[model samples]
Target: MKTEDEWQHCLTPEQYDILRKKGTEAPFTGKLLHNKEKGKYICAACGMELFSSEAKFDSGTGWPSFFDANKENIATKRDLNHGMIRTEVLCKHCSSHLGHVFEDGPNPTGLRYCINSASLDFRK
Candidate 1:
């Protein structure tokens, strides 16, 4: 496994900033926002599998939003930053901040797992 320092060296400054520091990438700038493939999205920090391609959908939100995460693969916490209350999602094992959850989502769950591409590693 790559150590934390190795990960820092492997990713670019912008990737490290957003993946490790919970920073946001500019809207409409994520490559995965329009990806349509059979794969899994893992945590860039620790390689923990987070979401499946089957759960992905287009929300016109300019980010990768999933209807659900892999079972027990993610952890969530209440975020009170940015002057608003939101649920912050993290990789369960790595605790790397992925993104936030909102109630406005499509279908069965009604949950939008809006995530930053910088925080995820796609595996086909």
Candidate 2:
């Protein structure tokens, strides 16, 4: 397992800011937003598999959006940040903030899991 300092060194300033500090990346700037590989998305913090490629889709919302996670692999907390209320999702084990969940999704769960690419590590 990587220590806090190790994670700080492994990620860039912008990546650390968003992934570690619960900040958001600039829209349409993430490389993985357009990725269509068959793989798994793991938490950058502790290497926990969160989302699969099958659940990923083009939401045209700049950031990568997923319909679901890997079978309860993520945990969520109600966020009241920025004077607004939203559900913030995190890695189940590490408690690393991934992003927020919205009710605007395609089907089934009706959840648009808007996540920052910096918070995830793709394994192909």
Q: Residue 27 CA error for candidate 1 (Å)? A: 1.2
**Model 2 lDDT on a 0 to 1 scale:** 0.88
CA lDDT of each prediction against the hidden true structure: 0.87, 0.88
User: How does candidate 2 fare on TM-score?
Assistant: 0.91
Cα displacement (angstroms), candidate 2, residue 78, comes to: 0.4
For candidate 1, lDDT tens digit of each residue in 1-124? 5566976898788778886788898878998888899999998877889999998999998899998888598889999999999999988886778999899988888999999988888999
Candidate 1 TM-score, true structure as reference:
0.90
The sequence of per-residue lDDT tens digits that candidate 2 reaches over residues 1-124 is 5577876898888777887788998889887999999999998877889999999989999999999888578998999999999999988887778989999998888999999988888999
lDDT, residue 112, candidate 1: 94
